[model samples]
Target chain A: MSTSTTLEEPKTGTWDGGNEPLKASYGKLMMWFFLLSDAFTFAAFLIVYGLSRHSHLPYTGSPEEFQFSTEWWPIPEKVFNAFPGFHGVDLPLAFVALMTMILILSSVTMVLAVEAGHRMDKNDVQKWLLWTILFGGTFLGCQAWEWTHFIVGTEEGMLLADGTRIFGANMTMNQYGPPLFANLFFFITGFHGFHVTVGWILLVIAFISTVNGVYHKRGHYEMVEKIGLYWHFVDLVWVFVFTFFYLI
Target chain B: MAAHSDHSNEFQQTGEIPKAQTKVIWKTFFILVALTAVEFLFAFTMDAGTLRNAIFIILTVFKAFYIVAEFMHLKHETKALIWSIILPMALVMWLMVALISEGSYYFDSIRNYFN
Candidate 1:
């Protein structure tokens, strides 16, 4: 029966439906597939994070005793409260919130650029793309500042009653409750930041192509739309990271 | 009337312009901003517990879908394409739940035995 089924004639052309059953362009569909795989990678990282956090030694007891039990995780707000130019002020989550806003704004500009591309307005496309690049660059700069601030070590830092001082952050040690917490923070946010950098490069190329009238000659600006899909995917990933890493 | 006809021909030369979607894009932007504000509010006000975490996850998923729908134009795509992307994500969710729960269970048992 299996051999008989194998001998059946192949369905070609209309009989097989179109090559792209979803009707998506090759580039767009490939971008979706890439995003799907990347999503799984992030999901694994986060699941490991949850597992590790559930097993970490949590800070407890008073300053005199300073007990550690496998029952607590570092509170994100207490760790990420510092903001640029504010220095001593206790502004919990302010800096990261600003970073989130900047990223969201960049996503808006990316969509605007794609929309302008649809109009075949080269000037508008260039303008919006430039704005998107600027916003993305600002977000990158903010991340750099945040990373530096984290590595510099606060004045108080984390002091134990036994006079053990934990300062700065690394794979093996962090002032945060557990080293695993810092490990996950660097890996997840660093991965997301790398995506933002890739989006920046893609936008710059799309901008240059727009200015050179390449898309204009093509009679469509689907290139801008394709890159826009990537930029928005970066933003979508940030939404999950923000909630999981920073908030919850 | 002649100028209007010329404009229509110009549109024909180019693909259909999505000028109408500008309003929708801005609306999504504001909605996202509002959601971020709500998240920050919860982060500051709500206690760290299951309820707060659940709310954050729900809100984050809402933001993710809104961005995919409006910004990526996934919502306007064919049902097959949407399902192709969404259905696979369900497996990711399953993996997350399975791994986290199992890991936590093991940790709980190990901690109890050691204590």
Candidate 2:
């Protein structure tokens, strides 16, 4: 059967030309464009990161002279070592792995929600969408824990061979590889985390709408699909983060 | 909107529909896992050498392609839309090459001048 234009057309009269103009709903199309621009912005940040990394380090002293940690630039694995408490267990990347799984699972649930939307199953749509939101929340919680762990020195307190306390921020270029690296890490990932929080809020609103019969009355679940696109975009950003920040 | 039809039987037969239009999430997931395992293997086994770094970056690009194409559903989009997203991204490759080369040069200079 021919897809009915009447059913698919934007209700808000956003369509300007009759040539189908991408033919997608206004929200979905706009989200795509927004993500495209956001992708470029991130690319610019990463490229600049590469450039800054290329720039010369004014090594005023020998590596042996650098006292705090023998390793240069806080190895991501060492820096982000907050896992569920198990005495005597050294889970270096356990938290990050959990965070990755949470984000991936959320993306899966989001796809399921959208699929339910397409099939017009309101109850299943709501159920899966709520699961997606829960997963997002769990990821955010884990991130908060990570930030706290990073900001606060270990429970054993800051230990230096020379008997000097290494404050978190002062754990800089000399101690943590490069000051710019830490700065960018906080700025870029923090910004992305903020976006994830916003996306989670939006998903929650969409979920509430679903429960209140907003989409049911409106006769389409396209809003959920639109939000799902946003959610998936967030997941895509994290994949880049994992590669650059962790693996690379 | 047309009344929600009783396609329950048809939907039940088909099972819960996937959000992605393509039926390749499982395939993509497996590919991603394999690529990641390779990355970890290389990370652990390879010595600190330029070749190892180069291979790592190549493997990363491969995994990135699958994620963008299949996971993000860009492969299913119209050619115009895909190009609009990709052409600008191509510039990032040049950016990476230029920046990394410059960084290495500066790093060597700093090492020599300060020491």
Q: Pick by lDDT: which candidate is best?
A: 1
lDDT tens string, model 2, B8-113? 3343324554444435665676676677667667755664345866776787677667766765667877776788778887877787788778888877887688
Q: What proportion of true contacts does candidate 2 retain? A: 0.35
The TM-scores of all predictions, comma-separated, are 0.87, 0.77
CA lDDT of B37 in candidate 2?
67
Residue B61 deviation, candidate 2, in Å?
Answer: 3.3
- For candidate 2, give the docking quality class from DockQ: acceptable
Superposed by TM-score, candidate 1 places the C-alpha of residue A158 at a distance from the truth, in angstroms, of 1.5
Off by over 4 Å in 1: A1-15, A57-71, B1-20
RMSD, one per candidate, in order: 6.4, 8.1
Interface CA RMSD of each prediction in angstroms: 3.3, 4.6
**TM-score, A chain, model 2:** 0.80
lDDT of 1 by residue, B1-115 (tens): 5555432334344454445358899999999999899988888777678899999999898899889999999999989889989999998888888877787787788778957
C-alpha RMSD (angstroms) for model 1:
6.4
lDDT of 1 by residue, A1-248 (tens): 45555477667763386476778888889988998898888888888887786665444434334423213577777788898888778788899999999999999999988888877877789999999999999999999998888777577777766887767788877776677787888899899899999999999999998887788778889999999998999999888888888887
